[model samples]
Target: MPRLNAVLETALYVADMPRARAFFEEALGLSPFTADHRFTAYTVGPSVLLLFLEGETTETVILPGQMGTIPPHDGSGRVHMAFAIDAADLAGWEQTLDAHGTSIEGRTHWPKGGESLYFRDPDGHLLELATPGVWPNY
Candidate 1:
C-alpha cells in the first residue's frame, strides 16, 4: 500500500443550504473558501467541509479545465464529524457555541483521557469538538 495522509474533504447534505451555511459560519466561525448555488465549502483547518443541498448533487459534476468529475453523492439521517482541538481550548469552544445559541447536545470522556463536546448543525448533523488524547496518535 502507498499510504493515506489525511482526509481531504467531508460533505453533509442539508435540506436548507443557507441555514446550514449560516450555522457553520456563525457557530464555528468558518468562512467559505468557495461556494456556488449547489454547495458551499469551508476550510476546516487543512480539510474541507462541504455543505451540499439535498438532491442537488445527484448528478456528476464536471470541473473546469477537465480536472476531473465528482461522482453523484448524497447522505441522509444523522451523521457525525469530529474536529481536533486543544484541551485548553475546550472551554472557549463551549462558550463560543453557547454564544451562538448552539447547545451542547452531549459529551463524552474517553478512556484515553480525551473529552468531546457534541452538538448539532442546522441540518442536525452531529458535530464534535474533541481534545487531544482522545486518540493514541493525537
Candidate 2:
C-alpha cells in the first residue's frame, strides 16, 4: 500500500473573479502561481488555493493535445477553510486584516493553548487562521 501526502489543494467557487482575486492577493498577500479566465491558483505554503469562477467548471477540461483531462468540479455557498499560523505572529495577522478593512467575525481560544481568528472571504467563505496547538498534528 502507498501512503498519502498532505493536502495539496483547496478550491472555492466565486461569483466575481476580480473581487475574489483582489481579496486574496491584496488582503491575504497570496500570490498566484497560475491564473486564467476560468480560475486562479495561489500558493499557500505547501498547498495550493484555487478560486474558480462560479459555473465555469461544469464541464471536463481537456488539456490541449490530449495531455490530460481534468474532471469538472465546482462549489457554491459558504464553506470553511483554515490556515496555520505561528503563535507569535497572531497579533500581526490581526492588524493586517484590520488594515485591509476586513472584520474579524469571531475568535476562539482552544483548550490546548491555541487561538484562532475567523473571517470571511470576499466570496463569503468562512476562513480561519489558527495557531499551532489548535490540533494534535498541526
- Can you give the lDDT of residue 125 in candidate 1? 86
| Residue pairs in collision within model 2 | none
Estimate TM-scores for all models: 0.94, 0.97
Please list the C-alpha lDDT of all candidates, in the order they appear: 0.91, 0.94
RMSD in angstroms, candidate 1?
1.1
Query: Which ranges in model 2 have alpha carbons more than 4 Å from their true place?
Result: none
- For 51-131, candidate 2 gives per-residue lDDT tens digits of 999999999998988699999898899999999999999999999999999999999999999999999998899999999
Looking at model 1, report the run of 10 residues with the lowest lDDT sum: 18-27
lDDT tens digits, residues 1-138, model 1? 999998999988899888888888888989998999979998888899898888899998998996999899888888999998999999999999999999999999999999999999987889999998788887
lDDT of 1 at 10: 94
Model 1 regions more than 4 Å off: none
The TM-score of predicted model 1 comes to 0.94
